[model samples]
Target: MSDASPAPVTAAILVIGDEILSGRTKDKNIGYIAEYLTNSGIDLREVRVVPDVAEEIVAAVNALRTRYTYLFTTGGIGPTHDDITADCVAQAVGVGIDVDPRARAMLLERIKPEDLNEARLRMARIPFGAELIENPISKAPGFMIENVIVMAGVPSIMQAMMDSVAPRLKTGARVTAETIEAGNLPEGGYAEGLAVIAKAHPGVSIGSYPSMTPAGFRNQIVVRGREPEALAAARTEIEALLARLQAERT
Candidate 1:
């Protein structure tokens, strides 16, 4: 084991479901989880939405689980036939999958044992040697196999599971952000200058976001980093660049 704590723990979100890809269901879990991870000092580096296909889910799980420190997957863990996240995760990790008794007991708390049919039993299926993530809203729990965390697609349930799992995760220093509003400044005019500023402050993450405000088009440059000093310096440089652009616009 390393003596020191890791500086930045990065993560990725894998959203699975054909309904999501088809635009039938609006994804609320991704944003919630991303913000949740950010607040917990874990950087959400990437997000990918894949269909419910087993091969695709397995592939995405394997790929992301290796790339980031944690991979949180939402969707396809339900009573329905399409809910195949548990099995897919098992296949990806090369582990045997089966109905976990603990999960069945949790399910029984809400559902009667005699009433537990095939569909309900599907929720009990978990990969070997995986830990359960609590879902207070609904008794059905999600599982964590290695770094990949499987959660319910329903936004509220997913949120609860995330809260339960958050404490157990290895978190790093929270990333701090400073946003500077460049009123009426066109991104095209400041793009090059912004790039230069970004390069100058390699320690901080700098980016320009152009939005259509009621006042018209406005740009905001946001500088994010774990170090307070780095954020201050980047913000100062960005402010200077915006001032110069404003002067030229006049």
Candidate 2:
């Protein structure tokens, strides 16, 4: 029997905007996209936030699109002069960009023909030979070229774009996780044991998260893996380690 597993599907996110880089517009799309990708069986491996500069956007688009199975970019696709994501993506993928007829038709759904001036037409610009992603909230559509998926900067619009593009994406085995609560347990106390468990279970990822509560420090150890058996085994070891430490403290 062939025991080789299928290649893992991975993705990266490029958040483009000067406002995000300057902290003026706090990004909400990254977290939403991460969770959405996770649930869809695609791992979000890397996230990069760059300014509105064309060079930076193009460089990030090229680098990320080549490295991962898919690259999702949010921001810079708007009506203003600063919305240059579409042009940068075209440059990165070595394709010519112009106002797509299909996209223009979509824009016409919400915008009057007379009001469809230069700036609004910018939203209709798409890379050549790329497919359009529907924006149900607004008429301005996002586009996908090669492995790069362009989206809006606004959280609501970006979320809607995700729904439109998700069905077409390639996916892999969905990762599952088990969380073990270590009440008032210091991470320092069980760090070594947790590391040992993590090393033993090569297929599973173990992480210890510590949070401050009104009672005291609360620690959560999460074991994540695609295989149910591996996750359960790791969770068992983690729970045992926590119990041993708690017993020793008493």
Candidate 3:
């Protein structure tokens, strides 16, 4: 049997909006999308947030789409003047965008035909030759053109769109993680030993997270990797190091 693993599937997120950049509207989508991608076996390598400027949006879209296996964008598809993400994505992909009838139909489901004015029609604009991503919440559909997936900025709608597109994505080996509860153990006590084990494993990623509670400070050491054998070996070493340090304190 062959031992070679499949090539990793990677993605990046591009958040567009003046509101997000100005701190007027706090972004809650990045973390959600990051976790979603990770669970789907797609590694989220980078995230970039840009304002409503067309040039900046286009530049960022072009850069990230080329760098990763897929690029996801949120925000700027609303019915306001600042909503230019669809246009920017079209420009970056060198395609013309127009009001897609299918998208208009989706809007019509939630909006009265008489109420579907120009402002509402803005949500129907989609890049040419793109597949629509269903939005169960608001019914304003997102779109996928080649490797770029565009969705609404709202947390609920974006999450729905992510679920809509999940099945179609190319996925790689899922990453597994093991966490060791170090209790009050200080990171400095095992930083060097942890670093050495991390270097030796190479495939596993080791991280120490500290949190505070009413009782005292608590620390957790996490080991993550795609290979089970490598992950197990790293976790064993980390546990031994922590135990040695605890014994020294006695």
Candidate 4:
């Protein structure tokens, strides 16, 4: 038979804001975007949080856009001097930046022509040869310059923009995940065996996560892969290992 399909498409997230680094504003967008991309068959591989500096933004955009299938940038696309992400994106792509008529029309939906001040009009600036990602919640649309998509910092607006662009993006096989719940088990006991299983099944990824909850400490071994059979095999190996260890303790 033909070989199984390749891994899911890859992506990276670039978070830009001074408030985030300063701890003044706790970030709520990264987790949301990570989960969203996971469900959309896009593997979010790298995440970077940079200050609202034009040079930093440009550098990150250049780096991530080249390294991944898609690059998602959140924050710095607002209506203030710190909102310099749009210009940075333009500069990164080596393209002239200007207020696009389409983007201006989107903003006009919320702001009247007379009230469209310069600060608000700044939202309409987009890089040359970029596509607008619609924001249903807010009239200020996000933009996609080639593979690098620039989005708002607000969680609601970023989610809306993602919904709009997801349909148009090229998606790959959805990565499936399996979790084996271990009750208060020490990760040290199974770390070596899990490593062996991981090496045996090169196609799958196995990770052990330990968390503390109100009830007590809990551990979970999560296996992720594209193939169901391979995933099941790895999970079986993990379960058997756990059973043997439990029996030995008893």
Q: Best by lDDT, which number?
A: 3
lDDT, candidate 2, residue 197? 94
Badly placed stretches (over 4 Å) of model 2 are none
Backbone Cα, N, C clashes tallied per candidate: 0, 0, 0, 0
Q: Give the TM-score of candidate 4.
A: 0.96
Candidate 4 clashes between residue pairs 3 or more apart in a chain or in different chains: none
TM-score for all predictions?
0.94, 0.98, 0.97, 0.96
Best candidate (score: TM-score): 2
On the 0 to 100 scale, the lDDT of residue 193 in model 2 is: 94
lDDT of 2 by residue, 170-207 (tens): 99999997789998888899999999999999999888
Off by over 4 Å in 4: 1-4
Runs of candidate 1 with Cα error greater than 4 angstroms are 1-7
Determine which window of 10 residues in candidate 2 has minimal summed lDDT: 213-222
lDDT sort, best first? 3, 2, 4, 1
| Candidate 2 Cα lDDT to native | 0.93
**Clash pairs (backbone) in predicted model 1:** none
Weakest ten-residue segment in model 1 by summed lDDT: 1-10
What is each predicted model's overall lDDT from 0 to 1?
0.90, 0.93, 0.94, 0.91
